[model samples]
Target: MSHVSVSADQAGQRVDNFLLARFRGLPRSRVYRLLRRGEVRVNGGRIGPEHRLQAGDRVRLPPVDLPPPRPPQQAPTRQLDELGACILYEDERLLVLDKPAGLACHGGSGIRYGAIEALRQLRPNQPFLELVHRLDRDTSGCLLIAKRRSTLRALHEQLRTGAVKKRYLALLTGQFAGRRQRVDAPLARYERGGERLVRVDAAGKPAATVFHARERYPQATLVEAELLSGRTHQIRVHAAHLGCPLAGDAKYGDPQAEARLGDIGLRRLFLHAAELEIAPLDGVGARHFSAPLPSALESVLIRLRQQTLTPSPP
Candidate 1:
């Protein structure tokens, strides 16, 4: 028999999901088999797979044969140093970094190493580092890391209650008129050809975004997109629905728009996470963080202004 106690970071997760994470190599069906056979119990009583765990709860499991855990792989020193160079802020409980474009937040699905993996390698002694939220692999900006389970729980609550403000900068394919526009639409996620895709649908979860025009050029417009609700691909899908898809977004953007900016060096999705603000949950003042756009993205704008025949909008 084995016993475990749920900590703050482990709270609110389903029993089966928690077990799956705890025993990394365990198959999903095997986890449920344990639950069905009463081989797993919480507080000395049988619990269903969907039971939500709470902090400090005790979990008991029956002994079963399992394979030995794999040895940890050491991340390349160069990758670790590169990630360290992007650090924007760090403290006892948080680690914030200016994540570069084309780097996944965490490793899986054939990727050898990602931001979190490299960070782990850099701080091999630190035990509790975990991502507070996630960003797309191609999106660059202020990524948050929580060093303490309590801090992670607090930040997760902030995200749930709309107390966290996330702002992103994007270049739309064509002129986006008006000062700002709110896209109040629902979105649904579906898998096609092993790729995840999100689309606006009435039956899906509620998703909203507010787009504010920051600057306008003849061919494309630079806009600030404020997410009212964070759904999968919310900004990208909403932008496409408005007919102003993000430049270089091959998944949701127009191909012609991408070609139009190809000469200007628009090689990836023209989206950047510019800022993050979280209202203090424990009587402290709000915390704000910002990341500057990468040089490559900035060069695209410079080239656009110089080559495009149309002048900047007044």
Candidate 2:
């Protein structure tokens, strides 16, 4: 049995991550099991895995196996270097990155390591580095990382209250009705064929997104999506509700359209986190960030433009 007072530096961390970090070799499954069984307590009360610790909170840990520390995992040299080069902006308090597609924000779920793990390896001495928000694995663009616990807490508050503005660019199919449109539908999640998916439902949490058409192609329309409420797969699900599923979206996309895109150099989801805006914090003014579309997606656009302009075979 052991009791530890959460320090200011340790505050705001979820119990699961705290346990994983504290016990070097502890398997994540074991950590959750302990939490589920009420073996871990906060100030004499059981807490869930997602419970954030606060300064001065007393946490009790039950007797558990603590294995010898495993060797520190070293990420691939290429991953480390790629993360370093993708930095759009960095300060003592935060890091803004133009994260490429196919890279997850955190490591897990068949991915041995992701951007967060690689960054930690690259800056081994940096005491605190945590993801402020998550972008889907196949979604590319501005992903935020906090350098301090205080920053992480503040940013999380901003996100929860919808103060931070996040916008994404995606290519949608079908005839978009107007130059601007808003999808105000709640979404619910379910599993099908062992894959998680979301659909609009009346009994789900409230969600909304406003989209502006950037341009239109022969078979698709490029649009910018402004998220009013952050929900799992909100934009993609909402776009589908509008009958304009995202191009190259395997889950809710048109198979024929996706097949056409697969021929035009669009190998991944045609989505990007194009912009982000954070309000003033701790006396600092608001900050904004933008990332240009990747060259691969851009190349597809070029080909689409040429196809649109060229004389069609009669």
For candidate 2, give the lDDT of residue 109. Answer: 61
The sequence of per-residue lDDT tens digits that candidate 2 reaches over residues 1-314 is: 89989999889888898888877668889999999998889999989999999999998888887987545566889778888999999989998989989888877667777789888898889998999989989999999999988898899999989999999999998777778999999999999999999999999999999999887777888889999999989999999999999988988989988888888888999999999999997789999999999998899889888878952221
Tell me the spans in candidate 1 whose CA falls farther than 4 Å from its real position: 1-3, 7-17, 27-41, 44-51, 60-68, 281-283, 308-314
Q: TM-scores across all candidates?
A: 0.89, 0.89
Residue lDDT tens for model 1, 1-314:
99999987688877997898787868788999999999999999999998989999999978867778866666777777888899998888889989999999987677767888788888889998889899999899989998887788788778888988999999998767788999999999988899999999999999999999977887788999999987978899999999899988988988888898897788888899999998874566889999999999999988877766665543
Ten-residue stretch with the least lDDT total in model 1: 305-314
**What lDDT is reached at residue 31 by model 1?**
94
Best by lDDT: 2
RMSD values, in order shown = 2.8, 3.4
Clashing pairs in 1: none
Error at 89, model 1, angstroms: 0.6
- What are the runs in model 2 whose C-alpha is more than 4 Å off? 14-37, 48-52, 66-73, 310-314
Q: What are the lDDT figures for the candidates, one per model?
A: 0.87, 0.89
